[model samples]
Target: MPIRLASRSLPLLLGLLLALPTSLHAQQPTAVIAAEASLESWYDPLEALGTLRADESVTLSATVTDTIAELNFHDGESVEAGQLLVRLSDNEAQADLRAAQALRDERRNTVNRLAQLQSRNLAPRGDLEDAQAQLRQAEAEIQALEARLSDYRIHAPFAGQVGFRDVSVGALVSPGTELVTLDKLDVMKLDFTLPELALGQLEPGLPLTATSAAYPDTRFEGEIDSIGTRVDPVTRSVTVRALLDNTEDRLRPGMLISVVVNRAPRQTLVIPEAALIPEGHRQFVLTLDPADEHRVTRREIRIGARREGEVEVLDGLNEGQLVVAHGTERVRDGQPTRLLGILDETTSVPELLRRGRDEAEASG
Candidate 1:
């Protein structure tokens, strides 16, 4: 009975021994995506959300207290510099102007009469001098009245689009009354803030690109017009202003925009975002030895900004090195690996899974 049991156990042991190599090979980390670290012209742009405003804006107001007699400008109309928009009642001012003009005319006649008498020596010199002084005084009064009358008409201070006015014809308005809004829309000003830690990168004339959700396809180009002199104590940030060309008048004032400033660029080592593996506070990645692609090992890398699906490798990595981008979880230090192909970060997961399946089928 003992000899019969040994024969049965031997066949089972041989069958289990044959399956060991297959199971071990299947468990090895399959590198379906191997990305090479290289020097990429990376953009380390600082980004922030900001508001867009007219390059020049103002609210037109009544300069003097008076009743609005006429509204010359329609709502939302383009106005040129010095174009009349509103007219205040000038009945009393006009009457005073007429009186001044009549007095001036009378004084001029008297002055002419006095000059004629003086030339002929028929009138006293003192009387002629008195008449001339009165004539000059009347002329000054006329000039003053004319200037006061001009104030009744309100003209556009600059070339811009005029907003609607709350007051209409016959409405009583006073100095500083809200009449309308004017905005120069040929160019736009964008104000944004960035952290104080980025002070070193702030400068005038930096190139910027701005976008808005209202016009997603449109990208407005601009540049840094100025930088704030002081940093905000509460936020530890500095304000920056950019000027964007709005000749088309597509950018509206008070609209929010996303800003990206082009910082000083340099070629640096970079890797795919998926290659980074966070282990506690440190990051880990699997790199293959050039001579032995199958010999994979874990390596730590210092990373900076992750933009456009690529990670900026600040340190702990070298250019032209190969790393496992996909199937990273299955990889460990001193593990077996198979280099499939160069897989970009944009590659879909289904494609990677299909590649892994094909490799597994071919190996089997």
Candidate 2:
């Protein structure tokens, strides 16, 4: 009888446990999740690498062979147009010019005397003509000598900053020898290469932006100046050039730069990056259905470009749908979910703190 009573009591206790109120059970609040639907108006950009170079660069050279007598300009000096840069030894040239002038004067006198004789019939016609020819030849010779004397001096062809001088004062320089380099850096060029697939997208005057590691925070703006006519066979890429304003002179030639090509504006569906779930070769997200009492459902979506903290959804999603941004792994498809609060309407803790500080200052 005692054993039967114990068995009955055990069955009764188990029944009581099963019949207990749900409130009496160990109950915890369901996990709260956040979500946002994909929306349009996401900006996608193409990035490339490039180098900055001076827009105009040239090597200054001697046009005539001569001894450098005086170097009027120093290395790395800013010179104005037509400024005298160097002077060669001009003693021999000056003497030659003087001799030519004297011969020209002598010929002039002979020609005048012959003309007088011809008028009086005291000289032959051929003699008078010969004197006239000699005067003409002498005049031509003087002009040629004067031109040669002008080559003894060198002047700046354009207004620009000069580079290091290769020849010094009293240094003999031959024709075509490099003296210095000149460059105009007020505006610069950014040269970069793009893949062959991007060739169709390139066009003149397209807006471009670039930044250098030296100045990471500052962005330089420019536009496509030109595109190469042929693609490089080895790299299968085409060269592109952009013109950037360097009025501040902060950017220098040969500086490595990162380029961003601003393609056509596009409107694409975008969602918070946190909502995406990657699994092998597929990506998915959890969405809430309001009509079905906020039931969570999993959805596969095609992702496009990502910028900032948002990602563009190319397909498999639409606007006005709620996606799970947090606590996604805990939920299942078609499962009933009780929203603790509207996740999309919530702001970050840092943002809230900043706003509170701003409000306090305003009130004070």
Q: Candidate 2: deviation at residue 268, Å?
A: 7.6
- Candidate 1 on 1-364: residue-level lDDT in tens? 3545577699888889999998977575556468889898876688899999898898878777889999878778889999988889999999998998898899889888988999999989998899989989988888888888788888888899888767878899888888888889889999999999988987898888999999999889999999999999999999999999998878889999999988876688888898889989898888888687567888888888778778988898888888888878877788767776676556665787788789779978
Instruction: State each model's C-alpha RMSD to the native.
Output: 6.0, 7.1
Best model per TM-score:
2
Error (Å) of candidate 2 at residue 45 is 3.0
Clashing pairs in 1: none
Predicted structure 2: lDDT: 0.80
Tens digit of lDDT per residue, candidate 2, span 1-364?
4545576699888888887865566443234455556456544477999988888887877777778898877777878878888888889889988998999999999999989989999999999899899899999998998888778877777877788877877788888988778777889999999999987777898888899999989999999999999899999999999999988878888999999987765677777788889999789998888788678878899997888778888888887778877667777888866554434446753454466557558977
Alpha-carbon error at 187 in model 2, in Å?
1.6
Give all candidates' CA lDDT scores: 0.85, 0.80
On lDDT, the candidate that comes out on top is 1
